[model samples]
Target: MGSEPGAGWEFARAAAVHSEVWVITRPRFEPLIAHALAAEPVLAPWIHPVYVDLPDWCLRLKKHHRDVYWYYPLWQRLAGQRALDLHREAPFDVAHHVTFASDWMPCGLTALPPTVPLVWGPVGGASYVPVPLLRWLGLRGAAAELARRTVTGACRRAIADRTARRAQLVVGLNDDVRRRFAGTAAVVVEPNAVVDPAARGSSGSSAPSRVRTAVFVGRLVSWKGTRLAVKALSHPAAANWKLEFIGAGPDQRWLEAEAARRGISDRVTCRGQLPREAVLAALDAADAMLFPSLHDSAPWVVAEACAAGLPVICVDLGGPPIFVRGTADGVSRVVDVGPGLPARLAVALRDSESVQRPTPSDRWSSARMPALLEAWYGQAAQFRAGRDAAGNGSSVSSEVGGLVPQTP
Candidate 1:
């Protein structure tokens, strides 16, 4: 994975164990990757680290803003050059681009030789906050969503289209991307892997709380639907319950004021961003996860909340629903992102007691990712070799032969 110091590290680390991985990432991740390799001595030979220094302007720009999405193409350009250099020395098989985890951001590796099959994503770009939902957000919120869509559209151009055309296999975070890039190569959907296996076990079985407590564990961003979660508490069914927000963002003040305006401030607690352990602890104590994000592409919090055995209340769109299990059995609720969200969320909160925590499957767990990824790598390699043998091949959609579990 190209470095962003998040889920990409987990995927790269796990892939190292099963395949010869050359991580073309930023220099900042060097220390962490070194420590991880030192901890696992056997991975030392298999995983190769290649760091690329971003331009001074790029680095400064990225630091100044959260949506430095355009900077990624430049980063990938450097990575592509580095990858070509490395491939010449080692004669690599398949080239996989792991991050800048957006389908709209074309992988630089896709520009590699056609014989070197390219695997793109487990990324997302198709999901967005519906225009109808914008009214729920205030002026600033609406503007933010508009800006996001505008940028996303600007980014989805020739480069990304070409990258999609060249990929031997494209792994989408959810069906949104799969549908968007439908005619482009074989598309498979699998959300990001749950990296820490130790975090898999239940956060212990506990009796139902007399007063249900729902937790929202993402940045207090507009699209996260944090306000919707707070507004839901105003519903009579969920009025008795409290909402604990556990992250910080630009919209923190707005969320707080909204809660106050709704007269639910007494029940809402914003615990800012805490350490990983603290977040998990909060999830363990909460009865349900209120993650009604309008546009999310495989959020880690959903997996973490489920790992803690907390039922999730996510929207019926994007990646959250794909990850949330047992929707039929009430383990999770996928509410529509519209005017009725508060009421639907309230019902989910009321039924939180009956919601059953889903068992984490091996396919979705990070521990088994090495195996799953090895299979993908093998397939990608075989496809590359087969195409080379045939002299040439056309870019056409093909059946996803022998791919495991249809969804994450």
Candidate 2:
């Protein structure tokens, strides 16, 4: 598992439960892992950093110095081939994978040493649509409809292609992503983890804002559909709303400029990147969340919003709808941007859920996430054991590697 800021947190948390965990982090983030563990009691002993020489999309931080993305297939193709060799040399139990920003993936799993099985963990999360883009394009009627269809198709294709390759058993965070891989993979639209609402200070409200506050958190990229959100503030219905954004990425400069142009600069506030807890706290104060993504899987933000009971304004695009129920109550209109988008959003926001958002984790029915993942893990291990017993060279090892221990 290549180390990432988010992945570091996930791996460390999971390690506390699963004793047989080994972490392979890119060389650049070794300090980050050490620093993170030093601060968190739960992660102190279970995570370790291993150095890998080859880098590509999988290990972008280390390999990007050479600008691997500039030259596509050459480095990437070799990297995929190299992954197989590395596993063969250091054969392990099932390969567990969880990714959000997956630019590239190893093509074939069947050809790996027959002894090892590669299992998909939390596969893909949703992308944040840049709200600014929709406002810039002002796409309406046929133009917005076409754009919506293209993005919807792209999202489906992404799910289908991914499921076809790496997943033996794909765990879905929501029903929508699960539907995309329904026939191909063992789809589980269950969340892998749960949130204890009482554990946190507060989430948000289902009731519409008494104080007109909104939150948007994600990367500052084109597809996030954040542009549309900013423009929405300038719209007649949302004139009173004040928004706080918590995130940073490539398009920060451009997005800020767009907000200023729309004459809602004072209403829109960009908080840059805040800690995870801080972002949640911001959500707790706001009346609703605005997630206008074009293409995405199941967005954790949406789950977080729903779990918090904060009404959300999400396009009925791929991932957003996974958590968004509809505009009826406690949720946004699930707006689909087309001819009538701005007009629809205008009307919907007026009747938006104004009640306190009930914490879904505390009061809702079962999504059955943990059980589904545990089942997938067991099946993956069993498959690996069978392969190794048959003397397949690529088998996940029968014996466990002694728990590597160190200070947190």
Candidate 3:
């Protein structure tokens, strides 16, 4: 129950504060959910878990990477049917698709009763690597990106379009996704990272040191731009900065080799995977986070870095920029993705060397999410009511006041 499933669980807990939550998930997670509920019995009554899975014969499709897409749609159909059956027994006011937070993916909740307002995403997947930056990724990575773009483009017009049109409110993970569904649906931008307030820690204590530590906390994947970070470390602009790589992947060897090749191996450290508490402790000690992910919708590390009051230096391309945007100057840097990205990243690294950490903001805090969810649910209901009043012909503006500001 980590990553996407963890996010779904958090949403259920948050929603349970206001209404009963029926959480539809895979059967494998039932034990984990039960354990979690046993620890916090108060939420047990409000959170109902409904396990849904495809037939045993279809399980093989889940084995392959590409085949999972085929399996997902089939699973959605089954989940939708199950939802329809449950609706007959107990009606729902709002249906939200939480996990698989991608705009191109179809949501089963769309099959809910038309009278029940649907909330789709804090989702993203519309962002892409710039052509020039694609060279940073190896040929295999580049081809994968191209294929993904093709698939996403086709799905956006077909499956995603239908889902967006069916949803009463579309909550985009970033502005790019909001723009993608802008004309077709009522869209609002919100990121998916929800940090615990207790995780907030003091930063900037290490800023004045002659040498600065920039940590990259994520899977060492090709598309994560770890190679670029390593290359930047060798640049004279970032001479004083050392990099720490957390998390593991196939790219670890390449990342290490690249650092050695660039003559900055001494300054680079690969810690592999660490516990969540250790990761937070690392964030508190580091001067900044260097997450130059090419097309990540919302990397949770960025929010965690913010919660630790650590500055973030990420590319202008995806949810990272959205998370760091409104902070005080020097608190974060969003480098543009194009030719000379490593050089530009080096400059950002140099610039972040002396900046004091910004105070942790409540923007991405979980404490604020319940109120935001309440507002989003209210807005979804209003949109549904307005559509019903206008014979399903009118479109309501997706704007709402007094909530956390939408992703800029």
Ranking by TM-score: 3, 1, 2
Per-structure clash totals for the candidates: 1, 35, 0
What TM-score would every model get versus the actual structure? Answer: 0.88, 0.66, 0.90
Cα lDDT computed for each candidate against the true fold: 0.72, 0.55, 0.80
Off by over 4 Å in 3: 198-209, 326-330, 387-408
lDDT, candidate 1, equals 0.72
Best candidate (score: TM-score): 3
Q: What is the per-residue lDDT of model 2 for residues 1-408, given as tens digits with 9 covering 90 to 100?
A: 222345434533554455444554335557766776687756555444543444355444534544543432333334334445655565545555443223233223334554555554444443333453344433452365456556645754654465345455665655554665667666655443333333454634443435477788888665676666776777878875777788997667766898788787888888999987787778777777877776665566766666665778877766567566621345455886676565566456555644445554442222343344456667766765665567756533344321111111
> Global CA lDDT of candidate 2, please?
0.55
**lDDT string, candidate 3, 100-189, tens digits:** 887887788777777778888878999998898888889999999999999899988889999998988899888889889999999998
Candidate 1 residue 111 C-alpha distance from true site, Å:
3.3
**Candidate 2 least-lDDT 10 residues:** 399-408
Ranking by lDDT: 3, 1, 2
TM-score of candidate 2 versus the correct structure, residues matched by position: 0.66
Whose lDDT is higher: candidate 1's or candidate 2's?
Answer: 1
lDDT (Cα, 0-100) at 134 in candidate 1:
86
